[model samples]
Target: MFKYLKNDIPASIVVFFVALPLCLGIALASDAPPLSGLIAGIIGGIVVGFFSGSRLGVSGPAAGLAAIVAAAIGTLGSFELFLSAVVLAGAIQIFFGVIRMGIIGYFFPNSVIKGMLSGIGIIIILKQIPHFFGYDSEPEGADSFIEKSGETTLSALAHITDNITLGSMIIGIVGIVIILFWDNILSKKHAFFKILQGSLVAVVVGTILQVVFSSNEALKIESLHLVQVPAPEKLSNFIDYLSFPDFSQIFSKDVVLIAFTLALVASLETLLSVEATDKLDPEKNVTPTNRELFAQGFGNIASGLIGGLPITQVIVRSSANIQSNAKSKLSAIIHGFLLLISVLTIPMLLNHIPKSVLAAILILVGYKLAKPSLFKKMFSLGWTQFVPFIVTILVIVFKDLLWGISIGLVIGIIVILVKSYQNSMFMKISEIDAGKTTKLVLAEEVTFLNKATIQKELFNLHENSSLELDIRKTRYLDYDVVEIIEDFLIQARNKNIHVHLLSERGNVDNPESFIEFLKLDKIKTNETN
Candidate 1:
């Protein structure tokens, strides 16, 4: 990890800037003190980063959990109680890791995963727009389409003209230009530009702009439109900001329920981020998901102990780290240290930085995640992939992350069911002088899901048909499908249909009964095995 210090150090600086506001914003959205987010960022970076197997994934207070955290805090009656829940949640996540439940991430389809990344990217862009223009109506880290202020994302945009601040707009536009130029032109031309990432440059320039315009009334940006790091007057006063959990509430039923919910949701978010980060990794190194859970659990436990919001392996910071040219987990660790030092030593300097500059950095990050090329590529993969991918994006954009993903999973499962039903059996019908001959070919694996389709096909057969059932390709036949076939065979007699059963063991004419035939088939299959 130390081997890439030259790259890691600079990359860490970029991630630090990217993570700073996010930490505060998430805390604000969660209705927790801003300092709590910083603590989580610190722990997530230093603690989780050290334990995580992932070389690039960055952990911090997640916007995805903002609503849950807010609701939990309110429901629990106190922040201290909520902190207890967070600690328990971390313990539960560690249990999940111990039991190897990290494999849950692998269960999500590739299309859905891609959709998640793209959807998050779109959300980041939308959420950042108001900040970029100095419209600070909604909290910085709120991810839902519907804001607590009662403004929808589209409506927010529509009102942008009325709320735009001259200083913020100017700084934001210049910041964006600097980043774009650095990424597209300056970085290509010079090594210095590569080492000093565009995001940092944009931030520096925006800070300088803020100072230069501070004296001008109309052009000045407000304190609310800048980074808001809590600045304690003295070093000793910092301890006052640290919160401790109420251990007495550990046994409370509501606390336990909240803990379980946090554990389940945080674990899921971590796994998905692990997958996304690995995909984004230049070296394509696979992270150990179970280890990631362990790291996250530890981070959250540490975070909760100090009155912080729950931590997860966040995609926003991870992607920012990757795009900033992070080399290893060292970058993530270093960023945490930076967060610690910034809050302790130079918070006022941080406060000088414009929110619009950070918004510009995130806009670029968002663009990378939701590139138009990705949409076209998904479409080219056919509807099987495209439908879920698009639905996930749309739902996430219009709703929230979890709901979008849940709906996408439903759509993906439905698509699978449809395909399974269609492929369960292959039927070919031919007209013969006697009547009609129907040949039914069973798939390699027949499940209960195929029963309805098979029954419908059977019902559609001609009254005087001669039916040939082929089971040579079938490996495992479900009991429900077998029952369907049995019921069809019984009905065949009344329809004057003659049935011929074909298997690897050759043909049988008019099997005595479906149950007996299935038993014989099973015996043959076992013998062959």
Candidate 2:
């Protein structure tokens, strides 16, 4: 773990900076105490990080679950009751992991996965627009297009002109410039620059600018526009911030329903985030999905026991970790440690950080995830891949992550069925002396989905024609397809069409039961009829 300290430490610092505002924002979005987000972040980073097989994924209170959390808190009558649900949710997630249900992540198409990341990137950038321009009406990590502030993603931009703060905007602009310069020029020139990290530098500069503008009322950023780290005032007083779940309510029906919902959402978000993070990792390391589910389960349980919001592997922070060049799980753990230490020790200083600065940093992160090149690359892969990829991004930007992914999955399935229908078999025609011959070659691993297409071809074969049916390359031909061929053979003899069956064993002249024939081992044949 210490082997890549140089890389991991620097990356962890960058992730720490990225996660700071996110923790507070997501909590606010969920209508929970800001400290709850911090607590979840701590557990996600430390507990989940330690147990997770993913080297780069960062977990925390995700914006994706903010709506459910907000509603759950309201429905459950008290935050304590909600905490009970969170604990139950964690137990449910653990059961899911033990059952190896993490395989659900594998069923998602590659196009849909790429679309998910790109869609998230677009959402991040869109949501951050108000923050970047110094409008703090919306939370930092909101996942939906329509925000709690009563504005859609694009509609909110209209209010920016009236609500934008000059001081925050100035710092945000400078931060973006600094990050761009540091990433493209300075870091490439010196090892020192790499150690400091562009985002960290931007955060420092933004804080300094906040202080510089303290004396100027015309340009001063309001407290609402800055990072709102909770200040406990004393070491002993910090204990009051921690609260345990009211386990008495854990068995209630409302609590049970909320717990199930939280478990399913959190588990899915974690699986998808880990998958996306593995893709973003420069080294292309694979994360164990089942292990990730287990890690998140424990993390959520710990968070709930200590009064934190529900947790998941947050892609925004995870992507930031990957972009920061994190080398191992150590980076995630270090970031968690830093969040705990900073929230407890130097929160006042952290509070001085302008939300706009973090917005600038996230804009960079979003750009990286949804670069124009990614669109072009997906497009070149053809409509089968690109259609689902593009659709996922659009839906995510307009609706939410879950809806967008669900839509993309449906589209991907349709594309698969279409492709299967088109390529189920190969057919050709030959004629000599007024006698016509048809050649039908079945595809490898033909399934029931191909039955209709194969049936259509056989139905079109003319009477008094010679037919050559080839299965030499076929493997695992579906029973449905075999029945179609068997029916066609019976029709051919009555239709007076001579047939030559081809397989590994040899040629057969319209041979008997296809069911019994298929019971034989797959054989190769070259003999002619």
Candidate 3:
């Protein structure tokens, strides 16, 4: 891994810039101390990165889990109790890994996965809009439609005009321009531009602009609009920020329930991110799913012990790492060290950075995830794929992440059932000298659901016509469908219709009894066996 330091170091710097604000934002959204988010980021990067099978996945405090963390903390009645739950969650994840349960991730449909990424992208964009214009009333990482501030996403945007700050707006605009220039123009002109990430440049320029406007009352940005780092006067005071889990709460029923809930959600999110990051990896490296669970389990355990929020493999930072051309896990590890060093030594400098600048950086990430081309691509795949994809995006934008995914999965399953019902059998009708000859072909697997359609076709058959019942392609025929065919053959004789049965055993002309024929065929098959 150290062999790629030239690539890893630069990528780590970019990821560090990308992760810093996210750590604080997620912590704030969880209603935990901002330091807890930072702690989780450090452990996720350093501890989890050391053990993870993924070459490029970055782990941290996930925005997707913020609402759960907030609610659990409230219900548990103390942050320490919540920390205990997080530790138990980690243990549960380890159990999942040991039992080789990582295969569950593969069961999610592709449409749902794509929908998830796009939904998260749109959510990031919508949530960042207010921050871009200097409105910071809502927490930075809240992704729900109904915010803690009692304002809907659209209503928050509507109130942006009233809360706009001139300094923040100016810096925000400049930051975006700098980022656009760096990405579209400068990066294309020189390889050096790639090393100097657009996000880092935007943050620096925004910081300088903040200093420039500090003296002018009309143009000054408020403290609320800047990054808030807990500045300790001494090293001892810094240690005081860390909180440990209360082990006494381990047996509490509520705590145990929350722990299982966290384990399930965190495992799912981690697995999905693992799949996504593998797709984005330039080298197409396949991460070991069970090993990833082990990494996350221990990472969360360590984080909770240190009074940090629960940890998971986050797609946003992982995508950022891939886009930044990260070559190995070294980049992730280095970024964690950077987070630790900066928070311990240079938090005041970090505090000088404006939230609008970070918002500008995330807006670019959001646009990349929810590009217009992706929507058109999904639509072209047909309704079966597009319906679930679009619904996932809309629900994630209007509701929350987990709910949106669940709803999309249900829709996708429904689409599959509908298609199965329609394609259960293939029928063809041709005119003959005697009458119309109808050929009915059963699918590979015929179920009871096809009984109604088969019954309708049989009843509509012309009298004195020839009917061919083809079961050559069928492997498993349901009892209900078989009975339907048997009943149809009986009725066909009364109507003067000629019935022919086609099977692997060849043609049978006017069998005495369909059921007797099936019984004879089964006996012959058993003898062959």
Instruction: Assess each prediction's global lDDT (C-alpha) against the native.
Output: 0.84, 0.81, 0.83
Query: Which lDDT tens digits does candidate 3 get at residues 1-529?
Result: 9999998898898889878877876675566777898999999999999999999999999876765687688778999999999999999999999999887777778898788777766766676677678875644334456665676666667667876888888888998899899989998999777656777888888999998899999778888888877889997798776788998979899899889878877898899999889999989999999999999999999999988899999987898888888899999999999999989998899788887887787677677878999999989999999999999888867765667778999999999888878988899989888488989888877678778888999988978998888878876677787678778878888888888888887778855765667545543454454
What is the TM-score of each predicted model, taking all chains together?
Answer: 0.81, 0.82, 0.84
Measured by lDDT, the strongest candidate is 1
User: Residue 436, candidate 3: how far off, in angstroms?
Assistant: 1.8
The TM-score between candidate 2 and the true structure equals 0.82
| lDDT, residue 64, model 1 | 64
Which is superior by TM-score, 2 or 3?
Answer: 3
Candidate 2 residue lDDT tens string, 1-529: 7789988998898888778767875675566776898999999999999999998899988866765686688778899889989989999999999999898767889899788778766666765677788875644324345455565545556656876788988988999999999989997898667555677788889999999998999888888788776688788988776877898878988899889878977887788888778888889999888888889899989999999999999887887777777789899999999999988888888788887887787677777878999999999999999999999888866765567778999999999899988988899998967999999998876888998888888988889998888888887676677678778878887898887878777777735744355545342211110
Cand. 3 TM to true fold: 0.84
The runs of at least 3 residues in candidate 3 whose Cα sits more than 4 Å from the true structure, single-residue gaps closed, are 1-14, 25-33, 63-85, 136-151, 244-265, 279-283, 315-328, 510-529
Better of 1 and 3 by lDDT: 1
Query: What CA root-mean-square deviation does each model show from the true structure?
Result: 4.5, 5.1, 4.0
Clashing pairs in 2: 504-523, 504-524, 504-525
